[model samples]
Structure formats: structure tokens, C-alpha cells
Target: MGSRRQFIKTVSASGAGLVAASAMGVMQEASAHPTSVWGGDIYSGPHEMVKNSKILSIKNPDGTETLGVVTPKGVIDVRAVAKKMKISAPLTLDQLLQEGNAAGFNKVVASADKSGVPYLDESKITYGRLFKNPGKIICVGLNYRQHADEVGMARPAVPPLFNKYNNSLAAHNCVLEIPPPEISYKLDYETELLIVVGKRMRNVPEAEALNYVAGYCTSNDFSSRDLQLELPSGQWMIGKTLDQYAPIGPYFVTSDLVGDPNNLKIQTWVNGEMRQNSNTSDFIHNTQHMLSYISKYWALEPGDIVFTGTPQGVILGMPKDKQVWLKKGDKVVSYVEKLGELKFTLG
Candidate 1:
């Protein structure tokens, strides 16, 4: 596992640089069309984005990441195949959805699958953050019935909302550095289903909410209990949005492939031992309800993500004397039925 210093250096040198470049690209695109609004021309719509496919973010040697399509043959590097075929395609997943280029992206995937070229070896490639900079990172707290009971809190009548900034985003198989003991020693894991919105929505009905989602992924809402519960004025944002605290993906399975988002099996294992084993059926506020509720207050844009609350069996649920927080070097794997497992280690 990489140390804290190494993680910071990598983010500063590579990740931050990529963010700046991506921002520039977005600015240029927006400048070309001044009349566009947040959910207007900026969003491409769900029809183009929600195809039945698994998408991967492959890190390039040049400190940038591109989209990779997972196929039966192997992982198709979209950038490599597009270059060889002399065709136009979006370079990154963010660009694919933001620019509404899924048709072009699909064309690249279809061509690469039939070209007979040897695709990338999945085991050999480095994974990148599936989302670099989503407009919003909304989270629902205490939405699970059993989880609320375990934590000695009443089931909330409505979904309690919170937010995490882009800084907390991390990729699959990434190693996160635990804060020093003096800062926070009581680290906990909360595995939950993540919702990726494909279309722009405001005041959307619950019946039409699922239609707006682009896809789903397994995500760990890693938390620091001391910073969350023991701090003055309850610093949920500080406790929840730590660097690399939200590690999502191994793949982003489209909504068509992951039908009935609220009924999937979700689980978490720490050091290969089962910690959370429950289905999304236990959710106090189901997927569509949460989406509809949030949309009433603000517009849900393409690339915005929502983390549904976790089920019971977290370290925080145990009695004070029996609680055992996550330590450095511990491996945690989060799994959802259709979405693949997301693994990360504490540094």
C-alpha cells in the first residue's frame, strides 16, 4: 500500500493536473455555445447514456484517463481503437456523457469488438476514478431501516441529505491513507449503492425518476466516526468527505443491465470477513423516492451522483466496548449484485 505522502504527491502532480485540463475542456466547450444552461445543452439525456454496457476508466501513462469498454473478448481501449480506425470518439467517460457523445462512443465500442485486434489485458491496466468532477455528490443518511435501528436512531420520515465534494472521489483498488490517530482513529465503512444521473431533472415525479438515471455502481462511503459524531456541531461533512473517502467502481453498469436498482444485493467485507450482508430491500426510502425528493429542491444534472445509505453491521453499530474501527493495512471490499466489487486498502 502507498503511504500518505505518496498519495498526496500523486494527487497533486497527476490528479490535480488532469482536473485543470478537464476544466479547460469544459470551458472551451461551453464558450462555443454561450446560450447553454446547466441542464440544457450541457446534458445529453438518458437515452444515449444508458446503454446496457460496463464502462471502465483506464489510466494513461501521460497522467490522464480514458474510457474503456468491457467486452467478452477483453477490455477495449476506446482511445487506442479510435485512433487506429481514424474515427471520432470521446476520450473520457465524463466527456462521453457531458457532451452527449454516447452514440459515437457506442460506435467505437462496436467497431473495436469486431476488428480482431488484441484488446487490453484487464489485469495489467491501472484503474482511474470513474468520475473526475461531477457537478454534485449528494448522499442520503440513515435511509436504511436496520441501520438506523443499529445506531440507536429513529428511522427518518424523510431522507436526510448530505453532500461530499469532488475531492473525496477515489477509484477502484485505490489505497487511502487513514488520518493520524490524533486526528481520527475511529474509521468506519458504509457500503452503499451509487446512483449516476444521466438527464437533467427538477421536480421530477417518482414514477419518472429511474428514467433519469444513467447507471449504478458499488461504492463505499468511508467515514470517520470521531469526526462525525464526537465533533462540535456534528461535522458530517468533515467526517464524510475526507480525501479518497468515496471509492467507487470496478465498473459502471448501465441502468438497463442493472434493472430494479432498489432490489439488488449489497455487501461489505473487511479483511475477507463479512461485515455487512443485506439487500437494498431494507431501505427506508427507496431509490426513486430519494431521487424525486432531491430533485424538488435542485436540478439533478448529468454526472451528478447520489449515495444511498448503507445497511446494518457497521463497526459503529456495535456496543462501545465491542466496536473495532478499521486500521491501516486493512482491505475492504464492497459488492452490489449487478455492479462488481470495489476493493481498497488503508495505507
Candidate 2:
């Protein structure tokens, strides 16, 4: 829930930087010879045949955004090379999911690798929101036992749900404008795992819920406790849904790459000092349970995201004398094992 002003200075020497890995799996090779695999035989229909790959948004100098694939060499500017090769590719993560362009996306990766297009150094590109536009941004509350206990609340029988709109979305390394002091005094940070829905679903069972996930990413449920708990409604939306409050990304890694979503290590830091250290294993309602429970009420479509609840160590759990609310010039970093760290500044 706290951050110091020296984040940018310390981040360079922190070695907690994002690493780009090349695309893996056979989709690249298979697409190269699609006609050779029995042209007139029974149709196998459409399916994603590759391993889950990492995708990101690269902000252009003019402020437009394009999709980039993280490779060992660097970032493959998909749109830049796709046009040069005269092949079609989605320019954003949302388009890649909503249009069912997995096959097309794979082809773009293969072409970029061979096209001699230079990879953009990670530092040279500014990140844009990982999701161009999410149809829904659902959030879960008190889903972790330790987090609930820290606030002196008993576990609820059902998963608590809340919602965030598109305006709240922010990119990794972006700057967040804290609401004027008149609006709130209690700015806090909650590190949570993000779930991205890949397919249209409703009333799904827990057994098959993972199949519907597009991928996973890191996220922060930035909050203002004064507006959240002190208001008349007693619900959390107002305090939690401020502009640039939901900072997510660095990469939207597919489920194939992220083996078990519930067992990974998750942590948060304020100005490089580790404040929260826990694993998703502490979740009271695991991934399958949360998805199944949510889909029962509303249909989840491609590009929809869900913010699973945070673990303990947030300022809200601290004693009144010890709590130091976040303020201007603070840096917050959220990290998950396979999903890279998401860093942001609060001003």
C-alpha cells in the first residue's frame, strides 16, 4: 500500500526487469505448409495448435498502438512487419482474441522471425494498455484467507464480486494521477492475479473452466479506502474504480505457458522494499471455482478480465499507527512468477 519516490532510479539496477522469450510450439511450422496436410480429406476444423505465447502492446511515437510478440531477440513489432509482408495480423490483444486469430497470430510470428525486421529493444518502446478494450473487468473480494483475516473479516460463503469500467485501465510503467486530496486520503495498492477470458461462456463447470481462459497477467487493484468504506453504499466500486486504477500487464501470457494459476508465487513492493509475499495457493476460492461461480451470472466473452483478490500485507491490514498511505511520487510493483512485473508511478 506504500511506495517511495526513488522507483525509476532504483528499477534500472533492481534486475527485476522483463525478459522476452521467443515463441515456442508448432503453429509457426504448420502454418507454413497448410496445404500439405491432406487438402481434400475430412476437415479437422479450427483449434489453437500452438503453445501459449506472450503478447504485448507497443505505443507508437504518434500515440497509436500496435501489437508486439516478445522473442529472445527482443520485441517483434507484428504490425510493422505484417504490412511489409502483406500478411494480415491483429494490431492489439483484444482483436487477436475476439477475432479468433490464433492461427493468423502464429503466422505473424514466423514471418517476423525470418523477415529481417529488426527487433525493438525493450527500453525503446513505451507500453500501451495490454488490453485495447475489455468487454468487462470483474473483480473478486476477500478470496484469500490471509487477506480476509488481516482485515478481521470472516470468510464469506460465496465469492464477492465487483466491477470496473474501461476508463480505469492503465499500462505497465504508466503514471497514475491520484485523485485530488479533497477526494481521498487513503490510497492503497493490492497485488492480484488477472484472468483473461478467451471464449464466450456461461454456466460453465469447474472441471472445464480453464479451457475458456485466454491467458493470465499481473494486476494492481489500486484503492482509496476513504471513498471505499466510508461511503453510504458500503460497497467498494467508487473508491476502487478511479481513472488509471487498474494497472495490468507487461504481457498477456496464454494458459499453456502458465501451467497452474493457483500455485504461483505473487508479491508486491513499494519502492523496491518487499511488502507482500504469498502464493496463489492461499486463495480461498481457486481459479476454477471463481470462474464457474462468475459465469453463472453473466456470459464471459473474449477479452473479458477478472481480478482475483489480493493476499495480506496491504496497508488496510496494518494497525492505525503503522499505516502509511501511498502519495504522489510513489512507485508500486506487482509480480507473479511466470507473469512479468507490472510497475507504475502514483502522482
Model 2 — which ten-residue stretch has the worst lDDT?
Answer: 36-45
* CA lDDT of each prediction against the hidden true structure: 0.89, 0.86
lDDT of 1 at 70: 90
Per-residue accuracy of model 2 over 115-215 as CA lDDT, tens digit each: 87899998888999997588899999988899999999999888999998889999999999999999998999999999999888899999999999989
Off by over 4 Å in 1: 1-47, 114-117
RMSD in Å for all candidates: 12.2, 18.4
Scored against the true structure, residue 126 in model 2 reaches a CA lDDT of: 96
List pairs with backbone clashes in candidate 2: none
Clash totals for all models, in order? 0, 0
User: Which portions of model 2 show Cα errors greater than 4 Å?
Assistant: 1-50
